[model samples]
Target chain A: MEKLNKDVWVFVEQRDGKPADVSFELLSKGRKLAKNLNGNLKSVVIGHDVLALAEETFRFGAVEAIVVDHKELGHYRTMPYSRIINQLIEKEKPRVMLFGATIIGRDLAPRVASYTKSGLTADCTDLQVSDVQYLRKDYKDLLLQIRPAFGGNIIATIISPDVQTQMATVREGVMRMEPLEKHVKGKIRNIEYTPDPVDELVKLIEQHRQENKVNLKAAPIIVAGGYGMRTKANFELIRELADLLGGEVAGTRAAVDAGFINHDRQVGQTGVTVRPKLYIACAISGAIQHRAGMQEANKIIAINSDPEAPIFGVAHYGIVGDAIEIIPRFINVFKQKLR
Target chain B: MQRCVQTGALNQSIILRIKKAAMGFNSIVMVKQVPDTANISGQVMKEDGTVNRAKLPAIFNHEDRVAIELALQIKDKFGGKVTAITMGPPRASDILRECLYMGADEAYLISDRKFAGADTLATSYVLSEAIKKIGGYDFVFAGRQAIDGDTAQVGPQTAEKLHIPQITYSEEILGIKDGSVQIKRKIDGGFEVLESKLPLLVTVIKDAVSPRPFKARRVMAYKNARTLLELEKLTEGNSLLYIDQLKDDYVNKGLYIHTLTMDDLKLDESRCGVHGSPTKVHKVESVVLAGGSHEMIEPTKEGISRLIDQLLEDHILG
Candidate 1:
């Protein structure tokens, strides 16, 4: 397939009819990339009926949208999505394909790339266009894929050689979502795909949402407990602070392992990356892994008995008081403020 | 903070295989031979200032293979397949063949010049793609952290990229039933039992399971699976027919040397490589230690008085 098309493609991720939040985020990023490349941003929406959201996607900046609407593609199985995306690349041959580095994107991106025999940059933190490659003649692309390297210490630059259409899977909230403006013009091309069951070796088992739905990323204000919380009962301090502020409770790796909070509520390299508005950390030593997840919050308030706890380094405000004693005070102040 | 550890002693946590079982559950262990970050030599970086990756001796991350072994033990309990996925330089293929010898069905090397210096975000992006390409899986497991970087970010971030609910820092898989996965995660001091749905990504900490020793025969049989570059080297000197036959034979034999480049993922050239990265190394400096003097104190008041006087003389205290 020739890479002649001069438009940008964002995988419009949808499940059960609604678009994933990351889709809007990617569309926001893709619009900028398309503008820089002097091209149009497009959407590859797949599902039973998602053409309706095509205009909404374009309103978010897509110039053209590609819809691979089909019933077999209703539930996202690896094989069908891969087949459809793979077929779209061959037929349309867009200059770029960016996906929300979500579960489906992670599952779908590589299979499509492998089928096309191209390189894929996963979980991209930044995106841009550049003239870079290891080999001059064969491996050169005009677009640049930016990502974090060395475990978020250094930013590594990756350039695809010769593949006109490059693929990258980006994580949620790495880039801010821009609001949709006026209605944008676009066309939706529907493609047909049928993958054999023998081709799909893995069956779709049922997916269950955790009973204690603690989504760390989406939570507004987070009260994070650390090992300093000591016993399980002490964790109530974290919950009380969160409840008083109309927020959610999170934990440092220490508190979570101490059996205080669910693993989903963990904030760090092994946990969730949350950029809440307020992060109140109690007795949590600032390990790099723990810091990675919650450091992005708009404001951080550290409450540790030890004045020198590492959490103080990045906190917007620091309090050298026992979380046990201080949490009650904080709850009182929060209650008064709310009233 | 370093925890005092006895290296070879097995934690009492690992549960070995029970009676007769169908060949065990299929398990794929992910391992990375990262640079030993602890040993920073006196010599500063080179002229261009890249912290010499060559001088850094690689160590199999202590936590990652434990994740792999946990999976292997799970496969031992339930009958199934374990396939390992690694995205790195050609030398990383060394670890993939090692995964095979340890007990993986087949391993794929997702190597490309394009992926040379990717960060965790990009690295997980590439691996997620490879996992997606690999197709079938009820579970995707990774080590808690790579020691060299000490950034345990990859595993959970990869799970997020895959858009699956992840159970990280697992010390053991206590139970795996119809739809839920119950596992023991290493919290700060103890452990927590977490139950999440199927198709979840788990990052295993050290002691998640006892790592099975490398099996000698499987290692010998599968050691010849050349990475893309290695295969290219062999084909360079061979008879046209022999090279063609060898390449086709490896593919048919299922020795996955799946190679993809820029054209594969259809990534925008602008968003990948170094240029796409907005973060830059503002600076790196040596951290100094300043508390290394000797102090003598006796039980008596006179001795204590002398110590206090010395501290006062040094302006350490009033």
Candidate 2:
């Protein structure tokens, strides 16, 4: 049997030249996974003129940077991107590869996985390396992909024990993005792009990507609502409270589904995870999936009519009352106290 | 790249048909009957961590239903046949009928016990083989992800197995012209328009289009549509009916939802199910959240005032 390469690789997804924040997060996570496997952490940066982006990976704890530069790869075209990554993986045989579960990552990962004939899991919230025994066979140092399945009711630990290269597309913000205290001068191995005619089959007609209007991940305070807000009118109270506190307004997936909030403003497992300084949960019966995203906040205040609501579990302060009424009182109290 | 090598010969025919705007495209849609995860209740997760699917009502996956709507809309605009296929137990024919009601011309059920415990890899293998066996398809459509597993890999994986290009998270069909189809797909913050040649796959998101309501006439016509296994069950309970005769009648009348087993697709036994899967479930844990001590606040004015004062002192707020 060919020995499995222990190197951990993070696909440093980039748009234009700037790299995605999730790529840095994966580098931070890949650092830990590399340490566990006693291997080097490498960043696979692909784009036109993304050498600086490749260098940036070292600041995020990568030991080496593999750069693939080409004009056709300036933007993320699925065909070219997947082919480049597939070629690298096939040659390197890295033990574990990670990609952010962003739109581009989701599109490219599976195609690459299938083309390489490797195992891939999607939207994983947590990843770890451990030995596993499956079907009366023992496997060493497998990537345990932990994710909430069946609408976040249960968590399943999935492992690709039989495959040489295990891959996963992790949800953004689930892993913390931490730069090293001192940036390491990592080795850069530049690779050539061998263009194929198939890359031209799908033509990029037009692209319109605006900066996200809601920067919930960077907000210091978040006021989030849930389905219990009753109507879209009542849900506006959450926005009022967030405004009074100079914070961002967010909501649960159910609230988003109910049309009280937009999907972009959603904060949960299926949505973006947030670690605001304070999270004010209004009428949210915190499902485990919801908490997986926001429970890490420094201080949490939950307001719900039901005292037994699960949101109170992680709340520093819990108020058992109707949010429609109590939120108005909260707004009034803040106004009077600030005055 | 091997798939791309054949694109040269394929492109010649595709280009030759560019002028025929009225000619419709042949489309195949992949659909699934998933457990209603949105309304989960009452011991749905067994002690062993496997889902007690019996407790949850099975329904057509919303995104997949949307994919069917898109496919039907394509067929309506361009003239073509729409076929829907699913791989599940015999009971999964329920969703296939729903597909027929929603305007699919034909439906197929690929079911067998040997396919049990299949992960995404094995599942995609079976589906790809089924699609190939059906053949003559210009487009393959699937939902972005299913509600049950939330793994969106099957569509793209199947596309890869079929050796075709795939455009995922599609929101709208921009246009189909000059031997290529244009699509508007969702990205992180906005959208992108991409154009790909015919004989590709598209995975749709929920916001793509609202699934059309089942037509009254179509429902009346296809409500009794049954797969072979269903017909066998009916005949087993009745002494008067002959299985072969009933099947022939159903097929003749176009009421027989086509059925395929592993043997029918000629799939490698090892690759049809769990044995061919590379990934395995190491552990399943029902989420149990432990609540620690917390301070309860009064709903009165004084309570609200004190909470504000505490926030000011803690510097969490000014």
Candidate 3:
């Protein structure tokens, strides 16, 4: 396995002919890594009728797009997907591989690593290229995999030294997507997938994707609550503010544990990561777990009764008052101004 | 003294015997003693960004306790034994004792000076080796993620090392029938039910079920349970405490916590600790949020209007 011939590969995940946001983010980041190592950036697209998505990878920054289109690949089934990926790695021998830390990726990456006898760092928050010296050995141009460990208490930087390929899965909303370059052309290579017998072991009977009216990812404004809300009924303030702003309501793990909001609305380490343009935190003390998810918001406004609350530390604007009283008045002013 | 019975009665007894024999499910629960991250202070973070674990008090991982409770529940439903295992320093025996108080039949501590400073990959390698040595287990249960590492990778990695299937983020065990188990797992929005065969690894979440309180009787009985290291310390400089006699007594009373070392497991020294971990700390910065000229808006109607005006001026609102 010669490292000189290998290129950087990003797994472009798509559903219903639309690429996931993280796929584009990976391509943007992969472009930098490939350039730093002086290698070609390739996008691997696998699904049914995803030719448009294969071509779309070029705009994000892929120098070449590899498509493995198959009818059985429409819905993500673990066995078939892992087998195909493992075979590709065995053949092309990529120097670096990236996947989104999504449900499908999380399930598939470990299996592929096991098949290829490689090391993988999961749910990474950051990736960089660096020269590493360990145990009296020099590893140049190594991909640094950075992630929060110990429940967000510390960060760990991982590298794969001995393996032919280095793999990592980046969490959503961590990396900013690079602006698309128009009129950029890239090579497209299509491959036919032949399924092995083991792929038939598991069958996808049905998939139920709940209709989410509050799209946190696409929401530009988010009014989030925390444990200070006290009760489920008190969440009405968050809902009212979000409704007024035409945004979505989110909560921390504490609020979810208290049943103030559904798990889907959780904005923290173990939940959905959101990077809204404006984040209004109502009586929410910012724990590191919650901050890791939303620290990238363009602007933050924290309102709390305690002036010393941690949320105020990260907020661009701090309001030291009770949310119960302030939110109502703020809503009235906004309504009048809009009128 | 054989008594003749009807054909239907004979068939019923045979079915019962077969069911009893086949349904016996033994479980091994992997637990860890982690530094309480919630109560971290300034000194908890070392200069190298690694945790100064000695500065923080250690506690049994909360989710691991739930894993033990689930294992015990499975044992209660089907007649089998439950063993708790952990890989840490000798003092980790404290968690093993807590596992006993929570109804574990036995406990083992995989401890050695060489096993220190292990990342998720090395830790899972050692744990998988210990599991393989322990042998006959229908299921291996673990927490979804340890609070300390919070990687949520060890359980799946250990399963991969052992060449077994894994179900993670498990919330409930529906049942076990015909050598297959049904599990309810938490997904993004809702939960899904999955069915897998025996010899599977399941990582449980905090929302699975509330762990049961320690039994008072069991606590009183296992309070003095000690590993070999602690026993050696007890006999050190104290002529009254003889090591062999104390060990025999503890073993007879079922209070001895089994301890294993690298030599016992025959593990490769190269793949045991920091040497095996590929992760290196390139840099760590302590993030201290400094409020940059934050304004304290008064809790008044005029103040609310001023805040709205400022937001609009800043283009935060329309």
The model with the greatest TM-score is 2
Q: Ranking under TM-score, best-scoring first?
A: 2, 3, 1
Q: What is residue B268's positional error in candidate 3, in angstroms?
A: 0.5
Error of 1 at B162 (Å): 21
In candidate 2 chain A, what residue range of length 10 has the lowest lDDT sum? A13-22
Q: Write the per-residue lDDT of candidate 2 for residues A27-116, one digit (tens) a residue.
A: 999999999999889999999999888988999888899999888889899888888888888888999999999988888888888888
Better of 2 and 3 by lDDT: 2
User: Per DockQ, what order, best first?
Assistant: 2, 3, 1
Q: Which tens-of-lDDT digit does each residue in A230-272 have in candidate 3?
A: 8888889999999999889999988997899987788876676
Tell me how many residue pairs clash in candidate 1. 53
- Candidate 1 lDDT by residue in tens digits, A140-163: 235666554443333456666555
Q: So what's the TM-score on candidate 2?
A: 0.95
Question: Lowest-lDDT window of 10 residues in candidate 1 chain A?
Answer: A203-212
Q: Tell me how much of the true interface, by contacts, candidate 2 captures.
A: 0.79
Error of 1 at A202 (Å): 3.6
lDDT of 3 at A118: 65
Total clashing pairs in model 3: 2
Off by over 4 Å in 1: A1-4, A130-144, A195-200, A205-212, A215-218, A226-236, A252-260, A267-275, A283-297, A303-314, A320-339, B1-31, B35-318
lDDT of 3 by residue, B1-318 (tens): 244456678989889968766668889999999888877876888776667778889999998999999999998888788999999998899999999999999999999999886766778889999999998888999998777766677787787787777777789998887677888876544556777767888889998998899999999999989888898898999999999999898899898998889999999988788776645555544445676656777778787788888888988787
> lDDT (CA) for every model shown?
0.66, 0.90, 0.82
